[model samples]
Target: ALSVLMPKVKVKKNAKSGKKGKDKKPQPKVNTLISKPKAAASLRRKLSGPEDVPVPDDDSGDLDEPAAAKPAKTKLKAAEPPTRLTRGQRKRQQRKENFLRKFELANLIGKQEEAFRTGSLANLADLTAHLEEDKAPATAKGPKRLGRKAQAAQDEREMAQFQGVLGFKAFQADPFGALEQHLKNSIRLQKEKEKTAAGKQKAKLSQLKEAFRSKKRLGTVKNKFAKSRKPKK
Candidate 1:
């Protein structure tokens, strides 16, 4: 009877507030290294959400089937025709081969010499023969014609050599010798012309004097005057 009387006095009901319908913001998930048991529990939680979705099996029937064999690889290449050497290239190759052959011969000669020095009696005669052959005077020949380019190079070299025929020392000592010679010739010619003109003038003056004497328009005057003195005008 006493409890009923106390509750009957008042029972205030607080409002539910706005928490019921408001949506909560989802937080970003962070994954830490978890033990197997923790991982299994987490997997269980995830499986609970997607219970209808099918999970992939680790060993499917496809793994039991044999895989398709890979096709054998083939290298495809274009057939290349043999290259023909040019005339110049062929000549150069031949010359190189000849040079190599000569080098071998020289090596053989050198070995023979070495053997002779070691008192090999068998090699001594051969070495002496070779030395004698070498000592024999060889006939020298004029320069060989290699090719057109070589001829051009030779011409250029000859021109250069001819250009320097007047020794550089003399040219450096008197660089203006040619010019000086030219100037001297000019001066000599001018002097000759002047002497000729002087001789001509002297001859003309002598002729005039003879003409005056012959005409008697000269000398003995001074008394009456020369030719009447032009009428005092």
Candidate 2:
């Protein structure tokens, strides 16, 4: 006879395990020593001290006395050497100086000629003063001296005038031409003066002739009247 097999029973597990309940974050192990407030207060009292240290007030007499005025430091400027000029700059400067010198010389010459024409010694005095200035000594505190070429040029200029004649380079270059020009100018001026005088004389003569003619006409009219009054003789 076959025995009937009994069906296996399935038991349901407990949803909450005793181990899980026991494992629960083991109550964060408290540090009893550190957690004692009384102990911490006693330790703090032992470590700390009184903070009231006294500082002495400054008693030096300097604090009471007026500060001596510090002597003002005068900044002495170092004398800088003159800047060296470039070749082109030097050339340009030389040219400018030459032009200025020539212009001044021309002006002086004109003044001298004018003085001569007007018979005045004032320009001569000025020229002498200028010459004196040129001859003045050149010291560090005084005016600078002329260069060799410039001094030579000055000497030549001094020598150029002799007996009321100017032996200038322009005249020396073409004396005949200069003379011819001078002659021409004089002749022109003379002609102009003669022309003016002739015109003035002609005008005077015309005025006199007009006056004489008018007087003669008046006399003739008077004579005619006189004859008419005298009537048939």
Candidate 3:
């Protein structure tokens, strides 16, 4: 036999809730551009030189007196004079740091070059690990910064072994300086060659333009003379 489903019972709504509630208007938004009393106090403290910041007076719950009537007093400590480094002294310190950094980089590059010349896999592997340790991230918080030009020179010197045409020997005396000088000479020669080629091209173009102008003038002259010699129509 089929079973019948039970019907759901409905509850009646309360008559009191049927009445409409009073409509309330939304509160106006406060403009932040107009400074509040507390913000004004902070600004006053900032404008007043580095002495102790004045605290704003707090209003008690009792509606007695407004905070603006009496300003809170702050104990001002005497400002200490700033320590400024002299220009010459700053330069000397910077130069000293730079010299130390250059010395360190030179030593590191020398080791890599020696490893390369020795043809020892273990030495090269150790050099690789050492280089990884000396990377930019290692000095993320330090004052040591490797110059881009120096880094580029080091990279070229390392790859010079594969560049037979360059005839660059990484194991030579002062390999870094030698390779850097060689790279500078190469760049200068390349620029000179480019300048010479550009000059030649410009000369050729000027000659072509002059030749065309001459031909055009001759054609115009010939046309004018021919027109002058023409028989009366």
Error of 3 at 217 (Å): 0.7
Candidate 1: residue 199 lDDT (0-100): 100
- C-alpha lDDT of all candidate models, in order: 0.73, 0.76, 0.74
Best by lDDT: 2
What shift in Å separates residue 145 of candidate 2 from its native position after superposition?
Answer: 51
Residue range 1-233, candidate 2, lDDT tens digits = 01111223334444666233433333334444347878756655556655565655776644567988999999999999999999999999999999999999999999778878999766567788999999998766856799999999988877764523455665778888877987999999999999999999999999999999999999999999998899576
Residue 143 lDDT in model 3? 61
Q: Write the per-residue lDDT of candidate 3 for residues 17-112, one digit (tens) a residue.
A: 864434433344443423476775665566665786565677454356554656678989999898899999899999999999999999999988
Better of 1 and 3 by lDDT: 3
**Candidate 3: stretches off by over 4 Å:** 1-171
Error of 1 at 80 (Å): 1.4
lDDT for model 3: 0.74
Please identify which of the two predictions, 1 or 2, would achieve the higher lDDT against the true structure.
2
Q: Which residue pairs collide in model 1, if any?
A: none
TM-scores for candidates 1 onward, in order = 0.24, 0.27, 0.28
Best by TM-score: 3
Count of residue pairs whose backbone atoms collide, per candidate: 0, 0, 0
lDDT of 3 at 170: 50
